[model samples]
Target: MSATERGESKIRIRPMEPMDIDRVLAIDSKITGVRRAATYTDLIIGDLGKIPDLSFVAEVDGEVQGFLLARRDYFGEPFSEEGMIHILGVEPDYWRQGIATRMVDALAETCQEKKLNAVRIMIDERDDQLQSLFERSGFRRGKLVDYTKKFKK
Candidate 1:
């Protein structure tokens, strides 16, 4: 069912702006049950690509209902540059409204315009639901492996 079918207003996907930061924090905190305000603040500051607004938001009647934060990555000279999707959050009230899918599509459109052939998001091995969503959205297991190293501060 579409948003209108569910009685929600039409969702407009557009480039995110600095002004949307507060609402973005609210939606993300709602989804993850944690407040990472500082993280998002840093992520969006001067992070937009040359394309103006590489990240985007989903709005309904001028109110932000969801957001997707992304950036371009350079892997030195050996790997091709690609777009990296760092975060996606929709207000809990707007779940199942296809808002996330639309946000991803918006990013894909931006990627296409930039002539980028790849976009990537990291999902935990156990998060089957999120993995399924991206898979349905045309992502497959790529060659790159997700790894990390930890250090004491």
Candidate 2:
């Protein structure tokens, strides 16, 4: 059945609530195979508390099928702001159903409403599927390079 025929005429997207933490962690853990409950708790409770509209979930038939967690970031000497999509995940069964795409569109709309310069995300170079998703959603490569360092005990 088509998405419309399957009663998904509209994918309900809404801000992530504190109650959504468990389901969010489940979905994230299912994808990454690691349950970082503390990390998600901070995002759902702390980050969402700060910028409620930036994080969202996709619901179908009243079940939470996917989620996108984003935040507002400021950088550069002049301090320009942008929306950053930190994490996105969908139920394994719902892959290729356009849930992620819709969530991204919702985020973009929110960014525009907030007058942010742009929306950005960092995808692993090897993850072609995710790269394609962002590309199809109108995201392009930027000049910024990501660097990380780990502290030794």
Candidate 3:
């Protein structure tokens, strides 16, 4: 069911602004434990500066509850536009209230408006809750491996 069908009221989704950095950082740090405030600052300012429509925040009762940052890029191999959901976080107290789902649906709507070929996101293999959430959102598993290599600084 859509967010509206689930009786979501007093919850508003709007384009993220630079003034939202503090609350966004707090939510991100609380959810992920990665407290690098500068990183989120750059992301919010830079990404929104480029494509304002790609970033959004979910607010309830005028308080920021969650946020999603996404970007669109064009790939050349098959020549297609794609949308990537880079980051997402919802407050612990608001969990299971379909806040993230609503944020994603909003992003998907923007992607559709931009004519993106697909929307993608990377989730940790052990995150069953996230996996289930995306699955319920009509996302299917794809055959791909996420590899990483760290270099000494």
Candidate 2 structure, TM-score to reference: 0.82
- Global lDDT of model 3: 0.79
Q: How well does candidate 3 match the true structure in TM-score terms?
A: 0.78
For model 1 the local lDDT of residue 48 reads 50
Q: What is the lDDT of residue 101 in candidate 1?
A: 92
Candidate 1 per-residue lDDT over residues 10-45, each given as its tens digit: 789999877887787777667777666455434454
**Candidate 2: worst-modelled 10 consecutive residues by lDDT:** 44-53
How many clashing pairs per prediction, in order?
A: 0, 0, 0
lDDT of 3 by residue, 1-153 (tens): 655446665788887877886788788778776676466535655754553447889998789999988777665576678887778889887888888998888888888888888888889889999999999888888776777898999
Best by lDDT: 2
Off by over 4 Å in 1: 1-8, 34-53
Tens digits of per-residue lDDT for model 2, 1-153: 766457655678988876887787778778776665566534544644453458999987787889898888876768889888878889887888799999999999999999999998988889999999999999998888889998999
Candidate 1 local lDDT, residue 109: 78
Q: Any residue pairs clashing in model 3, and if so which?
A: none
Task: Please give the ranking of all candidate structures by lDDT, highest first, separated by commas.
Answer: 2, 3, 1
